[model samples]
Target: MQQRKQQLLRRHRQRKRVALLLGLPLLFSSALWFWWLPLPLLLAAWVLHEAYFADHLFYAPGDDYDYRFAGAGVSVSITADGRLGLAQLEGIAEADTLLLEVTIKADWRGCWVDPRVLIDVAQPHDQQTFERGCAGRRVVNLSGLGPALAAGQVRLRGRYCRLAGQATLHVLRNPDYACQRMLILAPHADDAELAAFAQYQRGAEVTIATLTVGELEAEPYQQLGLSAIEAARLKARLRSWDSRHAASWGGVPAERCFQLGYFCMQLPAMRAEPLLGHPSKVAQTGDIRPLRKGNALPLPGDVDGQPSWFNLLGDLRGLIEHYQPQVIVTPHPQLDPHADHQATTAALYEALAVSHHQPQTLLYYANHLHDNDRWPMGEQGEGVALPPALEPLTVAGVWSPSLSGAAQIDKSMALGLMHDLQTPLPGKKKLRRVLQHYLAGRRWPRWGVDEFYRKAIRRHELFFVQPWPIKDQAQRPE
Candidate 1:
């Protein structure tokens, strides 16, 4: 307890130091009555500092899936020509691909310019720009620099920034997604697109199986002057349409998209009570059925689906057996904090266990990483490194498939088509609704608040790849 208190005291002191340094300027610049500007300014600066700088504790300090800085650095130096050269690269020839991680020191100057690290890869004539914000870190794949790295000729170029301490190099195996039969298991609409649209859209045989219609949401819809149930029903229908059409837009035909009409936010309850049926929290119904695009596999037992674990698992197993997919994409149960996301993968594990089915690769993604949506920290359209995360021990590999500028725009457009992704339309009661939303402490997407698109339309998509049937006991439930 004493040690804990000491740690807290240290953190508090650090925060106070930062607050005073930032807050004093505003206080000095303001009038007598406005002298209190420092308090709110201090709060805003502190939040941004924690989100972009501090490494010991991220946004979720006490949560199970909170991330920590797990980078290992090697000393490097820049030449007079401003080319960063690391001598250590010559000795490390084990992996063909590596992740170059660079950290920016936190301070006023570093935060102001938002430095961009420009790396020029020889042989391939490739260039990558890593965007940095206030003491933030970024990673870039070294696959394109394979020839130069093997010959100990790796060099990096940075613009308007100084190194924090040292840069890290993480060796990783790249997973091939070309022409593979891929199955995406999405807990809700837009998840498949958010996670892997750029990856599977071009060269892969993609089949999207959405677990729920997301009928539990009634917020922005209720602002449309509909009752709660009416809003829920409308949202379900529109999102179902969005899922199918969005997939279709990505070269996946409408015939390939499927929605297993389960209600949102109910999967965990279904898992806990396998035999019992649970109704939707908003729609207030227990009917669960498959909305098929084309005939595939029938749900076992009753024709009318029951919102039970048995039926959910049966449907999942049936889909797997029919598809025989080489790659299965779902959320990482350990990293993603959403209950539905964790439950979706949990059901997948159980289904694979019973059917004895094994895929070549199980790609895991985290849409909700307990980090308060502040991850992948950069401008839209920039390359995304692995977020500063406590690495999961059982991951077989880490893959980041790059997207062309056109593909990123296409993804942004596809996300725009989703009804839920549509920002709330201006209405007569706009001000009142905005005030109500704020008072209720609910996050409603206003115009230009496209958090999903900002995070999704990156230069590359990241996934933790695992081989199945997973042999790692730590990855599976006891």
Candidate 2:
């Protein structure tokens, strides 16, 4: 009787253990399924928003494309003999025929196919041609030919307005890319290379200029949540790392990298002149130099017997004048979410406004896509589009150009060299939280952040060009 009772008790305990094991899995699985439910809902919302509301920001079927272009203007050069600036027009003139054609480029607005070029063949010798609808062509016809424009010792003079808007962004119509010189501006170190890797492949003489020491992001307090000394050291290390990486990645000598030494995160509020005859949180000029690793000593308006060359605007203009780049690439001035990025754009624009040099194209790229905690968007490869509010100033639709497979790989490698989470900092936290920022959902703990950044690697890149006659001060400041 005792043995039979014991057997019964043992069997009952076994049954209870089996039940508990089965019940735990059901509870765990239910919790996981509940967490995944909202993720799909969020994705659906994003898709709906993009298709219905976002796609039509700048373009619709019947918006009357009148704002497509601006700044149709001309530049004139005259020569003696059967010679004109353009090869086609040079042959147009007979040995005794004086020939001059106006060369004009479509500005930030779309190109004017053939505006009008009026050649003043009127002089001591009134031999010339009166031409209309000729501003857009490199080789222009000498219409209504006369002696001064037609014959001996003709003095030709031309006046042209430098157009502001005419070049519009086109999905199909790519601008004559800048081959000789390219100037890329970044608010911080890693920004330029990420956006402009494709630009480098075009074989342009690329110059990347970074705006600050990049210390703010490594801040001992909020940025990386580091101590001051550690933050400064990290900033210096990052600057050095970026410079080295850019040189190697672009296949250019390292010296081409320019790091303008300014305090990070202060640009948007920075001023050239201090208030009330006092320097109030004034930026240290440091002789208007680039990326000095440490705090700059207080500097006077003038340095070491040199005239006051101590202004942000002046420094940027100096770079512009020096490079005379055919293309000036920077962040979207008004559209960018980051204050430093906006400030960088404004500074570049101000410098361009003052400098005599002109670039054929002013292109803008974007980042700061989501709140720091969210990323991947779960989609990519579609070209970048201007936000609807920015459509009027954008003038042309942004283009998404595809990169070669090798180029994409190179971009990935370059970005990888930028920052990492493997190394630990204070509080036993990783020095960089790029993973936490890039990947979406709870899966981040399971997958590495580098993998998400790599997944974001798209074959196509996108950008908006600022059209001249910008809509308002909100779009572009005077």
Candidate 3:
């Protein structure tokens, strides 16, 4: 019995020895595999999530987001929800670039996340670079980044566990005013006025295009202010009017006649055909497509199938691309004028939202006179004399012609004629006449013109500029 007990003990010892020798490696391998599962799976999951929710996952620091092109700098901030929060850009390259380093850490195993560098320029051109690193040390050669500079701004975004973040850097270049060009978008067919203005300023070369949409041939003239008898008479006189004024004036030819009514009698005339006769060249003339309402020009599409609102953005983009103008001028949003005018201005604002290459300046034009009650008759039987003029009349509100020179006024009026082309109502005629009178007061005080009208409403235009390179919030000036 003792011998049997010894044998059993030896067997037990042998089994224990075997377990001690092999158990550690097995446990170690299993543990290693278990820990590793999360790395690959988590990476895959993260990638997939990012594919769909990258914008949502990345959070911007403040309301302002910034970028740079050449020497110019811009600041723009987007919300976590991807809405544009704050934007300030300048055409001059006066700021520096920002460099950001991203690091990751966990236990002994060290790894470096790719660092993305963004730089905003004064012009549309910008640059970016990406590098991989961890802690304060670099690991990989990051050589594949390819020629660092690009034609547009850089967009950087990423997420990491509970610590994901992103920032933009701006690179400034020297200012080059000679490179500037201006683009004027008008709804009417009077390109001559704008062209003359452009020539007078020695500004960039200008191109004019016309668009014609619907017609008002069947519509009565009285609907446009003529009495029923007047409408009939006007209709009878339509043939003569067409032969006399319907002919094209600007370099661009006139569009087809959709309808022949008084409403269609405005400048550039509302025709069913493309007024410029060159639909293809509309963009070259700096005239965006899908013309807004009230103008003689109509955008391409069926009103029922393709609404003006829907196609406005695309048209604006096309215009920007075609003209490549440094500055864009359109009507103001506040005028609360005609439906088509309002709609066009609204669309222009919307287009500015997505435009990366912002225009340098935006000018707003006042609407024509509407009611005598709103604009009572003054001395001279016209609205108050615009600034730069000595007469006081009543038709529309007074405008300070002093701020804008006669040159500017002439250009503005010319552009207005090009855009409207319609005969001014009594109120509009009175206002125009007043404006004309002011033209005689060539040496008006600058302050007088400057003090014309308080921008009753905020006039906002959107454009992309170089991002300012500001590191610390405290260092930024108000």
lDDT for each residue of candidate 3 in 331-408, tens digit (9 for 90 to 100): 433322333344444555556667665665444443322211111111111112111111121111111111124444
Local accuracy of candidate 1 as per-residue lDDT tens digits, 383-434: 6655544443344667776677799888887888777766654562354334
Q: Where does candidate 3 have its weakest 10-residue lDDT segment?
A: 453-462
- lDDT-best of 1 and 3: 1
Q: Tell me model 1's lDDT, rounded to 2 decimals.
A: 0.66
Of the candidates numbered 2 and 3, which has the greater TM-score value? 2
TM-score attained by model 3: 0.30
- TM-score of every candidate: 0.74, 0.51, 0.30
Candidate 2 is scored at a TM of 0.51
lDDT for each candidate structure: 0.66, 0.46, 0.30
As a whole number from 0 to 100, the lDDT of residue 216 in candidate 3 is: 32
Q: What's model 2's lDDT at 13?
A: 60
